[model samples]
Target: MTPTLILAIAGGVLIAAGIYLLLERSLMRILAGVMLAGNGVNLLFLVASGPAGLAPIVGEDPELIADPLPQAMVLTAIVISLATAALLLAMSYRSFQLEGHDEVADDVEDAIVRRRAEADLSSEAYVDTSTDPNDDSDSESGGRFDGGRVR
Candidate 1:
């Protein structure tokens, strides 16, 4: 098979893996899928350079060298992948802390619902201490709650 065909087959495999990962409910898997998809696209870029181009950098005229465009694209892709992976990992950690699990109960829809619930909880000021009516406690008196509108 031609080099282009080989690249295409490899790219297709990566894309398929990415799609499969994306379908998972676990946030970690989803993020991984995104990364895989990005990599597949990067591969496609490399393959689509007409199978014969320059080395993208300052170099001697090497016969049949790949294009600079693909190399540039790959570098950008790497940076973007790193950034996206970092952000996704951060989000996964935050989700785990909030929900006590990595698998989100409602992968997509629950986000809005959970957010609204949190918003409501914050807005409701569950307590009504209202402050010390008889300012008896000294200003230096420390407590679990440092004086404020309980509700």
Candidate 2:
């Protein structure tokens, strides 16, 4: 097959796999997915930049000069991707150190916020802490909140 067709197919596969991995809960998988997506983007840049040819030097044969901008942008993108991957790896390591596993965990505070928001969606006002002088959520939450509101 032509090189262009090959690159297109490879890029498509990489993007698909990257998306699949990104949807997973594993940090390692997410890192891999980001890398794959970066590679796919690089391949797309290659394809968009057109066929490689002789350098675009002045006074040379006026035929088939490759644009250098896309190549330069792709290189910059590669460096950025590498930096991002390294950062993600370091964060993943730190997370693994703190928690026994690298799986993404739900924040209890976020869950509580969601529950409260859902409760507020109903027209019936239940346990309005602002007016209720005897709210117990603050006492039950181990002093995590002050004046019946989360701190």
lDDT of 1 by residue, 1-151 (tens): 9878998989989999999999998999999899988888998988886766655466766675665767788999899899999998998999999988778575564564566476665533244356675665623234343222232
For model 1 the TM-score comes to: 0.60
Query: In terms of TM-score, how similar is model 2 to the real structure?
Result: 0.72
RMSD of 2: 5.5
TM-score of each: 0.60, 0.72
* Residue 45's lDDT in candidate 1: 87
- Give stretches of model 1 more than 4 Å off: 52-66, 107-151
- Number of clashes recorded per candidate: 1, 0
- Cα-based lDDT for every prediction: 0.76, 0.81
Clashing pairs in 2: none
Off by over 4 Å in 2: 108-151
